[model samples]
Target chain A: MATFMDVHRGMTGITDEQLREAHAADLAIQDEEGVSFEHAWADPDSGVVYCLSEAPSPDAVQRVHERAGHPASEIHPVPLAV
Target chain B: MATFMDVHRGMTGITDEQLREAHAADLAIQDEEGVSFEHAWADPDSGVVYCLSEAPSPDAVQRVHERAGHPASEIHPVPLAV
Candidate 1:
Protein backbone atom coordinates (compact mmCIF):
# COMPACT_ATOMS: atom_id res chain seq x y z
CA MET A 1 0.00 0.00 0.00
CA ALA A 2 1.05 3.58 -0.53
CA THR A 3 0.17 6.81 1.14
CA PHE A 4 -1.65 9.48 -0.88
CA MET A 5 -2.59 13.07 -0.52
CA ASP A 6 -5.74 14.04 -2.36
CA VAL A 7 -6.93 17.57 -2.90
CA HIS A 8 -10.54 18.66 -3.25
CA ARG A 9 -11.18 22.09 -4.66
CA GLY A 10 -14.18 24.44 -4.54
CA MET A 11 -15.24 23.67 -0.99
CA THR A 12 -15.76 27.24 0.05
CA GLY A 13 -17.36 27.95 3.44
CA ILE A 14 -17.02 24.36 4.62
CA THR A 15 -17.81 24.02 8.28
CA ASP A 16 -15.99 21.89 10.81
CA GLU A 17 -19.06 19.74 11.34
CA GLN A 18 -19.42 19.20 7.62
CA LEU A 19 -15.79 18.30 7.25
CA ARG A 20 -16.04 15.74 10.05
CA GLU A 21 -19.20 14.33 8.56
CA ALA A 22 -17.57 13.95 5.16
CA HIS A 23 -14.52 12.29 6.73
CA ALA A 24 -16.82 9.94 8.59
CA ALA A 25 -18.50 9.10 5.33
CA ASP A 26 -15.20 8.19 3.75
CA LEU A 27 -14.21 6.12 6.78
CA ALA A 28 -17.49 4.25 6.53
CA ILE A 29 -16.81 2.98 3.01
CA GLN A 30 -13.04 3.22 2.61
CA ASP A 31 -12.47 -0.39 3.63
CA GLU A 32 -14.26 -1.58 0.52
CA GLU A 33 -11.55 -0.01 -1.58
CA GLY A 34 -8.66 -0.96 0.69
CA VAL A 35 -8.21 2.65 1.69
CA SER A 36 -7.88 4.33 5.05
CA PHE A 37 -8.65 8.05 5.24
CA GLU A 38 -6.38 8.93 8.12
CA HIS A 39 -6.78 12.68 8.25
CA ALA A 40 -8.03 15.73 6.37
CA TRP A 41 -7.49 19.48 6.40
CA ALA A 42 -9.31 22.33 4.79
CA ASP A 43 -8.78 25.95 3.89
CA PRO A 44 -12.26 27.18 3.35
CA ASP A 45 -10.95 30.48 2.14
CA SER A 46 -9.11 28.81 -0.68
CA GLY A 47 -11.94 26.41 -1.35
CA VAL A 48 -9.47 23.57 -1.00
CA VAL A 49 -9.43 20.46 1.16
CA TYR A 50 -6.69 17.89 1.46
CA CYS A 51 -7.08 14.30 2.60
CA LEU A 52 -4.24 12.01 3.57
CA SER A 53 -4.74 8.28 3.30
CA GLU A 54 -3.16 4.93 2.71
CA ALA A 55 -4.45 2.84 -0.15
CA PRO A 56 -3.42 0.24 -2.65
CA SER A 57 -3.51 2.89 -5.33
CA PRO A 58 -4.54 6.44 -6.08
CA ASP A 59 -7.71 5.08 -7.64
CA ALA A 60 -8.65 3.47 -4.36
CA VAL A 61 -8.28 6.77 -2.55
CA GLN A 62 -10.33 8.57 -5.19
CA ARG A 63 -12.95 5.87 -5.06
CA VAL A 64 -13.43 6.36 -1.34
CA HIS A 65 -13.71 10.12 -1.67
CA GLU A 66 -16.04 9.94 -4.65
CA ARG A 67 -18.25 7.46 -2.86
CA ALA A 68 -18.30 9.64 0.22
CA GLY A 69 -19.61 12.66 -1.74
CA HIS A 70 -16.50 14.78 -2.42
CA PRO A 71 -14.38 13.77 -5.37
CA ALA A 72 -10.79 14.91 -5.26
CA SER A 73 -9.37 17.09 -8.00
CA GLU A 74 -5.84 15.78 -7.62
CA ILE A 75 -4.59 12.51 -6.16
CA HIS A 76 -0.84 12.33 -5.64
CA PRO A 77 0.84 9.14 -4.49
CA VAL A 78 3.13 9.69 -1.55
CA PRO A 79 5.62 6.91 -2.09
CA LEU A 80 8.17 8.46 0.25
CA ALA A 81 7.56 10.42 3.44
CA VAL A 82 9.24 11.75 6.56
CA MET B 1 -1.61 28.64 15.47
CA ALA B 2 -2.80 27.13 12.21
CA THR B 3 -1.95 24.03 10.25
CA PHE B 4 -0.46 24.56 6.80
CA MET B 5 0.15 22.42 3.77
CA ASP B 6 3.03 23.56 1.62
CA VAL B 7 3.90 22.32 -1.83
CA HIS B 8 7.29 22.23 -3.50
CA ARG B 9 7.50 21.66 -7.20
CA GLY B 10 10.15 20.57 -9.69
CA MET B 11 12.15 18.23 -7.47
CA THR B 12 12.12 15.51 -10.09
CA GLY B 13 14.75 13.14 -8.76
CA ILE B 14 14.59 13.62 -5.02
CA THR B 15 15.68 10.49 -3.21
CA ASP B 16 14.45 9.24 0.14
CA GLU B 17 17.70 10.24 1.77
CA GLN B 18 17.43 13.76 0.39
CA LEU B 19 13.88 14.06 1.55
CA ARG B 20 14.84 12.98 5.04
CA GLU B 21 17.77 15.34 5.09
CA ALA B 22 15.58 18.27 4.05
CA HIS B 23 12.99 17.38 6.65
CA ALA B 24 15.67 17.16 9.30
CA ALA B 25 16.93 20.57 8.33
CA ASP B 26 13.46 21.97 8.69
CA LEU B 27 13.09 20.26 12.04
CA ALA B 28 16.38 21.68 13.20
CA ILE B 29 15.11 25.22 12.69
CA GLN B 30 11.32 24.97 12.92
CA ASP B 31 11.22 25.91 16.58
CA GLU B 32 12.77 29.24 15.76
CA GLU B 33 9.44 30.31 14.29
CA GLY B 34 7.26 28.37 16.71
CA VAL B 35 6.50 25.97 13.90
CA SER B 36 6.44 22.20 13.88
CA PHE B 37 7.17 20.28 10.74
CA GLU B 38 4.91 17.38 11.42
CA HIS B 39 5.23 15.32 8.26
CA ALA B 40 6.15 15.42 4.59
CA TRP B 41 5.25 13.47 1.46
CA ALA B 42 6.82 13.37 -1.93
CA ASP B 43 5.89 12.02 -5.35
CA PRO B 44 9.18 11.88 -7.15
CA ASP B 45 7.49 11.02 -10.39
CA SER B 46 5.48 14.21 -10.29
CA GLY B 47 8.30 16.28 -8.92
CA VAL B 48 6.13 17.43 -6.09
CA VAL B 49 6.61 17.49 -2.33
CA TYR B 50 4.07 18.22 0.34
CA CYS B 51 4.83 19.26 3.89
CA LEU B 52 2.35 19.34 6.72
CA SER B 53 3.08 21.71 9.56
CA GLU B 54 1.64 23.68 12.45
CA ALA B 55 2.68 27.30 12.43
CA PRO B 56 1.64 30.81 13.17
CA SER B 57 1.28 31.62 9.48
CA PRO B 58 2.10 30.41 6.01
CA ASP B 59 5.08 32.77 6.00
CA ALA B 60 6.62 30.92 8.93
CA VAL B 61 6.28 27.65 7.10
CA GLN B 62 7.80 29.17 4.00
CA ARG B 63 10.65 30.68 5.96
CA VAL B 64 11.60 27.35 7.45
CA HIS B 65 11.52 25.65 4.08
CA GLU B 66 13.48 28.50 2.49
CA ARG B 67 16.15 28.39 5.16
CA ALA B 68 16.22 24.60 4.91
CA GLY B 69 17.04 24.95 1.18
CA HIS B 70 13.72 23.88 -0.38
CA PRO B 71 11.32 26.73 -0.46
CA ALA B 72 7.75 25.75 -1.12
CA SER B 73 6.04 27.06 -4.24
CA GLU B 74 2.67 27.22 -2.59
CA ILE B 75 1.55 27.33 1.02
CA HIS B 76 -2.05 27.04 2.15
CA PRO B 77 -3.32 27.54 5.63
CA VAL B 78 -5.50 24.72 6.90
CA PRO B 79 -7.58 26.16 9.67
CA LEU B 80 -9.92 23.21 9.89
CA ALA B 81 -9.16 19.52 10.11
CA VAL B 82 -10.50 16.11 11.01
Candidate 2:
Protein backbone atom coordinates (compact mmCIF):
# COMPACT_ATOMS: atom_id res chain seq x y z
CA MET A 1 0.00 0.00 0.00
CA ALA A 2 1.09 3.60 -0.56
CA THR A 3 0.81 6.39 1.97
CA PHE A 4 -1.16 9.48 1.09
CA MET A 5 -1.72 12.83 2.76
CA ASP A 6 -4.91 14.69 1.99
CA VAL A 7 -5.86 18.22 2.92
CA HIS A 8 -9.26 19.77 3.60
CA ARG A 9 -9.70 23.50 3.86
CA GLY A 10 -12.38 25.96 4.98
CA MET A 11 -13.23 23.97 8.08
CA THR A 12 -13.13 26.90 10.42
CA GLY A 13 -14.76 26.55 13.85
CA ILE A 14 -14.75 22.77 13.70
CA THR A 15 -14.43 21.04 17.04
CA ASP A 16 -12.35 18.09 18.14
CA GLU A 17 -15.44 16.01 18.73
CA GLN A 18 -16.71 16.76 15.24
CA LEU A 19 -13.43 15.74 13.65
CA ARG A 20 -13.35 12.50 15.60
CA GLU A 21 -16.88 11.75 14.53
CA ALA A 22 -16.00 12.36 10.89
CA HIS A 23 -12.94 10.16 11.15
CA ALA A 24 -14.97 7.41 12.73
CA ALA A 25 -17.51 7.63 9.95
CA ASP A 26 -14.74 7.28 7.38
CA LEU A 27 -13.30 4.29 9.19
CA ALA A 28 -16.65 2.53 9.17
CA ILE A 29 -16.75 2.52 5.38
CA GLN A 30 -13.06 2.75 4.45
CA ASP A 31 -12.68 -0.95 3.85
CA GLU A 32 -15.28 -0.80 1.10
CA GLU A 33 -12.89 1.42 -0.85
CA GLY A 34 -9.68 -0.38 0.13
CA VAL A 35 -8.45 2.55 2.18
CA SER A 36 -7.26 2.71 5.75
CA PHE A 37 -7.10 6.02 7.54
CA GLU A 38 -4.12 6.10 9.86
CA HIS A 39 -4.46 9.47 11.53
CA ALA A 40 -6.21 12.82 11.28
CA TRP A 41 -5.22 16.30 12.41
CA ALA A 42 -7.17 19.51 12.38
CA ASP A 43 -6.31 23.16 12.82
CA PRO A 44 -9.52 24.96 13.66
CA ASP A 45 -7.73 28.29 13.52
CA SER A 46 -6.68 27.83 9.91
CA GLY A 47 -9.64 25.75 8.80
CA VAL A 48 -7.38 23.00 7.59
CA VAL A 49 -7.73 19.30 8.23
CA TYR A 50 -5.10 16.73 7.26
CA CYS A 51 -5.54 13.00 6.96
CA LEU A 52 -2.84 10.38 6.54
CA SER A 53 -3.89 7.06 5.11
CA GLU A 54 -2.58 3.93 3.48
CA ALA A 55 -4.46 3.02 0.33
CA PRO A 56 -4.23 1.31 -3.01
CA SER A 57 -4.24 4.71 -4.71
CA PRO A 58 -4.97 8.37 -4.06
CA ASP A 59 -8.31 7.86 -5.83
CA ALA A 60 -9.30 5.28 -3.24
CA VAL A 61 -8.54 7.70 -0.45
CA GLN A 62 -10.57 10.43 -2.11
CA ARG A 63 -13.45 8.04 -2.66
CA VAL A 64 -13.59 7.22 1.01
CA HIS A 65 -13.48 10.87 2.00
CA GLU A 66 -16.11 11.84 -0.55
CA ARG A 67 -18.40 9.10 0.64
CA ALA A 68 -17.93 10.35 4.18
CA GLY A 69 -18.98 13.83 3.06
CA HIS A 70 -15.59 15.41 3.70
CA PRO A 71 -13.93 15.47 0.32
CA ALA A 72 -10.33 16.64 0.46
CA SER A 73 -9.18 19.81 -1.26
CA GLU A 74 -5.84 18.28 -2.18
CA ILE A 75 -4.32 14.82 -2.20
CA HIS A 76 -0.67 13.81 -2.59
CA PRO A 77 1.31 10.65 -2.34
CA VAL A 78 3.79 10.58 0.52
CA PRO A 79 6.83 9.12 -1.10
CA LEU A 80 8.94 9.34 2.03
CA ALA A 81 8.35 9.46 5.77
CA VAL A 82 10.25 9.82 9.02
CA MET B 1 2.71 22.00 24.88
CA ALA B 2 0.45 22.59 21.94
CA THR B 3 0.66 20.68 18.70
CA PHE B 4 1.37 22.61 15.51
CA MET B 5 1.27 21.55 11.89
CA ASP B 6 3.55 23.42 9.49
CA VAL B 7 3.61 23.26 5.74
CA HIS B 8 6.46 23.92 3.31
CA ARG B 9 5.94 24.49 -0.38
CA GLY B 10 8.12 24.76 -3.49
CA MET B 11 10.36 21.94 -2.39
CA THR B 12 10.44 20.25 -5.77
CA GLY B 13 13.35 17.88 -6.45
CA ILE B 14 14.16 17.62 -2.76
CA THR B 15 15.15 14.16 -1.63
CA ASP B 16 14.09 12.10 1.37
CA GLU B 17 17.60 12.12 2.75
CA GLN B 18 17.62 15.91 2.60
CA LEU B 19 14.35 16.12 4.54
CA ARG B 20 15.61 13.71 7.17
CA GLU B 21 18.80 15.67 7.54
CA ALA B 22 16.88 18.89 7.94
CA HIS B 23 14.59 17.27 10.49
CA ALA B 24 17.54 15.98 12.46
CA ALA B 25 19.12 19.41 12.42
CA ASP B 26 15.92 20.85 13.80
CA LEU B 27 15.84 18.21 16.54
CA ALA B 28 19.35 19.06 17.51
CA ILE B 29 18.35 22.63 18.32
CA GLN B 30 14.65 22.25 19.11
CA ASP B 31 15.14 21.91 22.85
CA GLU B 32 16.79 25.30 23.01
CA GLU B 33 13.58 26.77 21.65
CA GLY B 34 11.09 24.59 23.55
CA VAL B 35 9.95 22.68 20.46
CA SER B 36 9.79 19.02 19.68
CA PHE B 37 9.33 17.70 16.16
CA GLU B 38 7.05 14.70 16.14
CA HIS B 39 6.98 13.60 12.51
CA ALA B 40 7.54 14.76 8.94
CA TRP B 41 6.02 13.81 5.59
CA ALA B 42 6.89 14.91 2.10
CA ASP B 43 5.18 14.71 -1.29
CA PRO B 44 7.85 14.76 -3.96
CA ASP B 45 5.26 15.18 -6.67
CA SER B 46 3.56 18.13 -5.04
CA GLY B 47 6.60 19.77 -3.43
CA VAL B 48 4.85 19.96 -0.11
CA VAL B 49 6.31 19.04 3.27
CA TYR B 50 4.35 18.72 6.46
CA CYS B 51 5.79 18.75 9.94
CA LEU B 52 4.01 17.97 13.18
CA SER B 53 5.50 19.35 16.36
CA GLU B 54 4.77 20.09 19.97
CA ALA B 55 5.90 23.52 21.04
CA PRO B 56 5.26 26.35 23.46
CA SER B 57 4.23 28.58 20.58
CA PRO B 58 4.09 28.69 16.81
CA ASP B 59 6.99 31.11 16.76
CA ALA B 60 9.15 28.63 18.53
CA VAL B 61 8.37 26.04 15.89
CA GLN B 62 9.13 28.50 13.15
CA ARG B 63 12.41 29.42 14.75
CA VAL B 64 13.50 25.83 14.74
CA HIS B 65 12.58 25.43 11.11
CA GLU B 66 14.18 28.70 10.14
CA ARG B 67 17.39 27.73 11.84
CA ALA B 68 17.27 24.45 10.00
CA GLY B 69 16.90 26.43 6.78
CA HIS B 70 13.55 24.97 5.71
CA PRO B 71 11.10 27.66 6.75
CA ALA B 72 7.48 26.66 6.53
CA SER B 73 5.02 28.50 4.35
CA GLU B 74 2.26 28.13 6.91
CA ILE B 75 1.85 27.10 10.50
CA HIS B 76 -1.39 26.26 12.28
CA PRO B 77 -2.29 25.09 15.72
CA VAL B 78 -3.67 21.59 15.67
CA PRO B 79 -6.51 21.96 18.12
CA LEU B 80 -8.07 18.60 17.27
CA ALA B 81 -6.95 15.08 16.60
CA VAL B 82 -8.27 11.59 15.90
Candidate 3:
Protein backbone atom coordinates (compact mmCIF):
# COMPACT_ATOMS: atom_id res chain seq x y z
CA MET A 1 0.00 0.00 0.00
CA ALA A 2 1.03 3.61 -0.61
CA THR A 3 0.23 6.77 1.28
CA PHE A 4 -1.39 9.79 -0.34
CA MET A 5 -2.23 13.32 0.60
CA ASP A 6 -5.04 14.68 -1.51
CA VAL A 7 -6.14 18.32 -1.57
CA HIS A 8 -9.62 19.64 -2.14
CA ARG A 9 -10.27 23.30 -2.88
CA GLY A 10 -13.29 25.63 -2.92
CA MET A 11 -14.84 24.31 0.28
CA THR A 12 -14.93 27.58 2.10
CA GLY A 13 -16.78 27.79 5.38
CA ILE A 14 -17.10 24.03 5.70
CA THR A 15 -18.50 23.12 9.09
CA ASP A 16 -17.33 20.30 11.32
CA GLU A 17 -20.54 18.43 10.64
CA GLN A 18 -20.06 18.68 6.89
CA LEU A 19 -16.48 17.50 7.14
CA ARG A 20 -17.52 14.54 9.22
CA GLU A 21 -20.22 13.62 6.77
CA ALA A 22 -17.84 13.73 3.87
CA HIS A 23 -15.25 11.66 5.66
CA ALA A 24 -17.86 9.13 6.58
CA ALA A 25 -18.99 8.91 3.00
CA ASP A 26 -15.47 8.08 1.92
CA LEU A 27 -15.10 5.47 4.62
CA ALA A 28 -18.38 3.84 3.69
CA ILE A 29 -17.24 3.03 0.13
CA GLN A 30 -13.47 3.09 0.55
CA ASP A 31 -13.25 -0.68 0.53
CA GLU A 32 -14.67 -0.83 -2.95
CA GLU A 33 -11.60 0.87 -4.29
CA GLY A 34 -9.11 -0.61 -1.87
CA VAL A 35 -8.53 2.71 -0.16
CA SER A 36 -8.57 3.72 3.44
CA PHE A 37 -9.29 7.34 4.28
CA GLU A 38 -7.43 7.76 7.53
CA HIS A 39 -7.77 11.40 8.56
CA ALA A 40 -8.56 14.79 7.19
CA TRP A 41 -7.57 18.34 7.99
CA ALA A 42 -9.32 21.46 6.83
CA ASP A 43 -8.58 25.16 6.79
CA PRO A 44 -11.97 26.58 6.12
CA ASP A 45 -10.56 30.06 5.75
CA SER A 46 -8.34 28.96 2.88
CA GLY A 47 -11.02 26.63 1.53
CA VAL A 48 -8.52 23.80 1.37
CA VAL A 49 -8.93 20.31 2.79
CA TYR A 50 -6.24 17.68 2.99
CA CYS A 51 -7.05 14.01 3.26
CA LEU A 52 -4.53 11.35 4.18
CA SER A 53 -5.09 7.79 3.03
CA GLU A 54 -3.43 4.51 2.26
CA ALA A 55 -4.31 2.92 -1.05
CA PRO A 56 -3.04 0.73 -3.79
CA SER A 57 -2.50 3.75 -6.01
CA PRO A 58 -3.31 7.40 -6.42
CA ASP A 59 -6.08 6.41 -8.80
CA ALA A 60 -7.74 4.39 -6.07
CA VAL A 61 -7.58 7.32 -3.69
CA GLN A 62 -9.08 9.63 -6.27
CA ARG A 63 -11.81 7.18 -7.04
CA VAL A 64 -12.87 7.04 -3.42
CA HIS A 65 -12.91 10.85 -3.09
CA GLU A 66 -14.61 11.37 -6.41
CA ARG A 67 -17.28 8.88 -5.54
CA ALA A 68 -17.70 10.57 -2.18
CA GLY A 69 -18.49 13.80 -4.07
CA HIS A 70 -15.35 15.73 -3.14
CA PRO A 71 -12.93 15.31 -5.99
CA ALA A 72 -9.40 16.33 -5.17
CA SER A 73 -7.68 19.18 -6.94
CA GLU A 74 -4.30 17.60 -6.37
CA ILE A 75 -3.27 14.10 -5.38
CA HIS A 76 0.27 13.68 -4.15
CA PRO A 77 1.85 10.30 -3.62
CA VAL A 78 3.75 10.04 -0.34
CA PRO A 79 6.11 7.23 -1.23
CA LEU A 80 8.25 7.73 1.86
CA ALA A 81 6.93 8.40 5.34
CA VAL A 82 8.34 8.57 8.84
CA MET B 1 -2.74 23.48 19.53
CA ALA B 2 -3.12 23.59 15.75
CA THR B 3 -1.97 21.14 13.12
CA PHE B 4 0.37 22.28 10.41
CA MET B 5 1.47 20.84 7.06
CA ASP B 6 4.72 22.42 6.03
CA VAL B 7 6.29 21.97 2.60
CA HIS B 8 9.97 21.81 1.78
CA ARG B 9 10.99 21.82 -1.85
CA GLY B 10 14.20 21.31 -3.78
CA MET B 11 15.25 18.25 -1.90
CA THR B 12 15.31 15.88 -4.83
CA GLY B 13 16.90 12.45 -4.35
CA ILE B 14 16.98 12.61 -0.55
CA THR B 15 17.73 9.22 0.97
CA ASP B 16 15.71 7.54 3.70
CA GLU B 17 18.61 7.83 6.12
CA GLN B 18 18.91 11.56 5.44
CA LEU B 19 15.20 12.05 6.01
CA ARG B 20 15.35 10.22 9.33
CA GLU B 21 18.27 12.34 10.50
CA ALA B 22 16.44 15.53 9.63
CA HIS B 23 13.29 14.37 11.38
CA ALA B 24 15.31 13.46 14.43
CA ALA B 25 16.84 16.92 14.60
CA ASP B 26 13.39 18.50 14.70
CA LEU B 27 12.18 16.03 17.33
CA ALA B 28 15.13 16.86 19.56
CA ILE B 29 14.21 20.55 19.92
CA GLN B 30 10.47 20.48 19.30
CA ASP B 31 9.70 20.54 23.05
CA GLU B 32 11.51 23.84 23.50
CA GLU B 33 8.90 25.56 21.36
CA GLY B 34 5.93 23.52 22.55
CA VAL B 35 5.69 21.67 19.29
CA SER B 36 5.54 18.03 18.33
CA PHE B 37 6.81 16.80 14.99
CA GLU B 38 4.48 14.03 14.12
CA HIS B 39 5.07 12.46 10.72
CA ALA B 40 6.66 13.38 7.44
CA TRP B 41 5.99 12.43 3.82
CA ALA B 42 8.41 12.87 1.00
CA ASP B 43 8.10 12.71 -2.77
CA PRO B 44 11.67 12.79 -3.91
CA ASP B 45 10.49 12.74 -7.49
CA SER B 46 8.82 16.11 -7.01
CA GLY B 47 11.50 17.23 -4.59
CA VAL B 48 8.84 18.07 -2.05
CA VAL B 49 8.66 17.01 1.57
CA TYR B 50 5.67 17.55 3.80
CA CYS B 51 5.97 17.62 7.58
CA LEU B 52 2.96 17.31 9.84
CA SER B 53 3.17 18.80 13.31
CA GLU B 54 1.18 20.18 16.19
CA ALA B 55 2.33 23.65 17.06
CA PRO B 56 1.10 26.82 18.68
CA SER B 57 1.69 28.71 15.43
CA PRO B 58 3.16 28.43 11.99
CA ASP B 59 6.17 30.37 13.16
CA ALA B 60 6.93 27.71 15.70
CA VAL B 61 6.81 25.03 13.06
CA GLN B 62 9.09 27.01 10.82
CA ARG B 63 11.48 27.72 13.64
CA VAL B 64 11.92 24.04 14.34
CA HIS B 65 12.46 23.23 10.67
CA GLU B 66 14.84 26.13 10.26
CA ARG B 67 16.81 25.04 13.27
CA ALA B 68 16.95 21.57 11.79
CA GLY B 69 18.69 23.06 8.72
CA HIS B 70 15.71 22.59 6.39
CA PRO B 71 13.47 25.62 6.37
CA ALA B 72 10.01 25.07 5.01
CA SER B 73 8.95 26.71 1.77
CA GLU B 74 5.28 26.85 2.69
CA ILE B 75 3.36 26.19 5.87
CA HIS B 76 -0.40 25.65 5.90
CA PRO B 77 -2.45 25.70 9.08
CA VAL B 78 -4.86 22.82 9.52
CA PRO B 79 -7.19 24.20 12.14
CA LEU B 80 -9.70 21.36 11.94
CA ALA B 81 -8.95 17.67 11.90
CA VAL B 82 -10.78 14.35 12.15
State the lDDT of candidate 3 residue by residue for A1-82, as single tens digits.
9888888989999888899999999999999998988989888888889889999999999888888899999888878889
DockQ-best of 1 and 3: 1
Model 2 quality (TM-score):
0.98
Name the candidate that leads on TM-score. 2
- Per-residue alpha-carbon lDDT of model 2 for A1-82, expressed as tens digits? 9999999999998998899999999999999988999999998877899999999999999999998999999999988888
DockQ of each: 0.88, 0.85, 0.72
Cα lDDT of model 3 overall?
0.90
Ranking by lDDT: 2, 1, 3
TM per candidate: 0.95, 0.98, 0.92
- Expressed as tens digits, the lDDT of each residue in B1-82 for candidate 2 is 9999999999887798988998899999999999999999998877899999999999999999999898999999997898
Considering lDDT, which of the candidate structures 1 and 3 is the better prediction for this target?
1
Q: For residues A1-82, what per-residue lDDT tens digits would candidate 1 score against the true structure?
A: 8889899999999999999999999999988999988899999899899999999999888888888889999999889999
Recovered share of real interface contacts in candidate 2 = 0.84
Label model 1 with its docking quality class: high
- Model 2: DockQ score: 0.85
Q: Write the per-residue lDDT of candidate 1 for residues B1-82, one digit (tens) a residue.
A: 9889998999988899999999999999999999999999999999899999999999899888999999999899989999
Candidate structures ordered by DockQ, highest first? 1, 2, 3
